[model samples]
Target: MKITVLGVGGMGSRFALMLHQGGNDVTLVDGWQANIDAIRKDGIQANFNGKPVSAKMPIYSPAEIDQSGVKADLIVVFLKSNQLDAMFKRVQPIIHKDTYVLCLLNGIGHEDVLSKYVAKDHLLLGITMWTAGMTGPGHVELSGDGEVELENFEPAGEAFAKQVVSVFEGAGLNPKYSHDVKYSIWRKACVNGTLNCLCALLDCNIGEFGKTKQAPELLHTIIDEFAAVADKEGVNLDTEEVYNHVAATFTSDIAGHYPSMHQDLVQNHRLTEIEFIDGAVARKGEQYGIATPYCKLLTQMVHVKEQLVGAK
Candidate 1:
């Protein structure tokens, strides 16, 4: 299989390495100039599973992708939710008639943007439990085990989706073809809306926040709001189940880790996907005449933090 991985940051680089090791022809596309130059000079420098590993493969910027004449059978996207539209437009030349574009981005409503770029049969959306960390350009740390649950955007596209699942399986990606992936995406959103947002706000890691006496109350408040909004969006989320799923992550193997939002807004001083996560829920809540005080306040707080840090 020939694959192109967009946004070759922490998680993106991890997936590219795994698929390459699985014997697929994998190329990378990223917007960061430093990352592109570093990988072009030294391949990918990875501390994978606590071992130093290096692999050489082609890497390109989004602009370089078209001129390089790369035609990909599969394009697995791992960009931040905000970067989706522009990146897709830049990579238009590589998207053939039958190419499968799988979105493993976080939060909700990505399919809305993706549908504008590709046909429904060629689109797949999912959530991944995979975690990764970037130390520098072209360097990443990958650890632990994660699974990906994805489904075709259209019911008639299942056959191709199964083929993509097989390819992911060969890469040890632990792929599951889901009939109800919307529920899964919303469940994962609950995890991010609470853990990611609160951790970034409190300036703490997952376990540290979990140890606080108010953790459960905070989790319920945010998750109940998410459940209300998700219901309005035609996805019925089990509030208890979603709460437990998120609570478990506080003690999971990655408990000490700061989530991606923290890495962005707090440490790196960058813009976050707040609008896609809790902010998305808050908007839906307003549309449905439902109250989402927690989400609304959290969304505002994250933006304030962004402004304070002068985040781009």
Candidate 2:
């Protein structure tokens, strides 16, 4: 299989190296000059599965992807939610009629954006429990065990979904096909809405946040809001199940790891995907005549912090 991974930061690079070493042709696409130079010169210096390892493969920027005229059977998107529109536009040269597009991006409402770029049968919706973090240029620290749940966003697209599954399995990526992936996506979004934002605001990881007496209390407010909005959007999320899932992450192997939003705004001083997570829930609440004060306020606070530091 020939694959092009968009947004080759942490998750993208990790998957690219895995797939390439799995005997598939994989190309990494990123906007970072230092990361591109490092991989092209040395290799992808990744701590895959908690062991120090390295893998070499092609790395290119978006412009170079266009100039090189490369194409792919699969295009996996792992971009920051805010960068979806612009990043998709830049990677136009990779999409073809039969190309399958999968969005393993965090949060909700991303299918609307991806639908504009790919046809129904060629579209896939999925979420990863995997964790990866960028340590530096061409280097990532990937640890622990994670599984990917994927489903065809379009009906009758099962065959194509299986094809993508085979590729992931070949790379030792535990892949499962889900019939109710929307529920899964929303469940994951709820996890992010609770963990990512609060962790960012409190400057802590899952373990640190879990240690607080108010952690579950704070989670209830956000998850209640997310549950209401998700219900209005035709996905009924069980509050108890969702809460348990998010709470479980606190004791998981990656509990010490910083959530991505913290990695963006707090550590790197970069922009966050607040709008895509809690903010998206807030928007849906307004549309459906539901109040989402918790999400609204949290979203606003993240933005205010971003402005205070002039985070991009």
Candidate 3:
């Protein structure tokens, strides 16, 4: 398959390398000139399990993508939500009419924004439990297992979802087609809401947060409020199940790893997805006439921290 990865940062670079290694025609696109130049000079440097590996493929900036004049069968986007608008605009010209655009971003509301430019049938929503980070430009470090759940929107069918899953599975990432992707996305949000914020606020990794006394209590509060919001939204989410999942993730193979949110704050980048996880729950809680004081407070605290750090 001819694949193009837009926003080739951490996860995007990882996916691009995997697909290329699987023998697919892969091209990596990013806005950063240093990353593009580095990959073009050398190769994509991927550190997995503390061992370094490299994959040679075409890497280009958005401008270069425009100059190439090549179309892709599939385009996987892994950009921050704030960059979505401009990124889509830049890539629109290169995307073919039949290209399947899969979004592997965190949070909700991305599908709606993507649909405005692409056909709904060509859109796929995805969620991942894998943890990764960009160690440097054109370099990515994989911290744990990569598992993805994907599904198509209203105009797509199961066959399309399976085709998308096959591409990821071929690349060694365990990808599955889910009939209820909405619930899966919500579940991921539940987990992210409980842990990511706590990690950012406490400046700790998953295992370290689990070891703290206040971590579990705060997590319980966040999950409880989030579950209430999900229930009101008619999304089936069990608090106990969600809590157990969050707890297990800390002890899982990815234990001791810091979440992307924490990494963002440490790198002095603005954390926007907090608005999608905790802020989303709090907003829905108000609409459902449920109290979400804890969630709201945490969201405000994170915002304050961002303010102090001058994060964009």
Go through the candidates in order and give each one's C-alpha lDDT. 0.91, 0.89, 0.81
**Once model 3 is optimally superposed onto the true structure by TM-score, how far is the C-alpha of residue 163 displaced, in angstroms?**
1.2
Q: What is the TM-score of each candidate against the true structure?
A: 0.98, 0.97, 0.94
Give a tens-digit lDDT track for model 1, residues 1-312: 999999898899989999999999998999999999999999999998899998989999888877988999989999999999999999999988878899988899998999998998889999899898888888988888999999998987899899888988999999999999999999999989999999999999999999999999999999899988888778898899888888898789989888999988887788999999999999989999999999999999999999999998
Kindly list the per-residue Cα lDDT of model 3 for residues 1-312, writing each as its tens digit.
888888777778788887888888998888878888889888889887788989878877776667887688888888877788788888877787888888888876788789887898888888987777888877888766768898887655457678878878888989988888888888888777877888888888989889887877887888888778877767878777878888987678878787878877766465556777788878878888999998899889888888888887
- Ordered by lDDT, highest first, the candidates read 1, 2, 3
Error of 3 at 179 (Å): 1.0
Query: How do all the candidates rank in terms of TM-score, highest first?
Result: 1, 2, 3
Task: Write model 2 residue lDDT over 1-312, tens digit each, in one string.
Answer: 989888878888778888888999888888878989999998899887767888888878878877877899999998899999988888888899989999999899998898888887789999999888888889898888889999998886899898888889999889999999999999999989999999999999989999899998999889999998888788999999889989998888989989889988898888999999999999989999999999999999999999987898
The candidate, 2 or 3, that scores higher on TM-score is 2
The total number of steric clashes, by the backbone 3 Å criterion, in model 2 comes to 0
Query: Which of the two, 1 or 3, has more lDDT?
Result: 1
Candidate 2's error at 49, in angstroms?
3.6
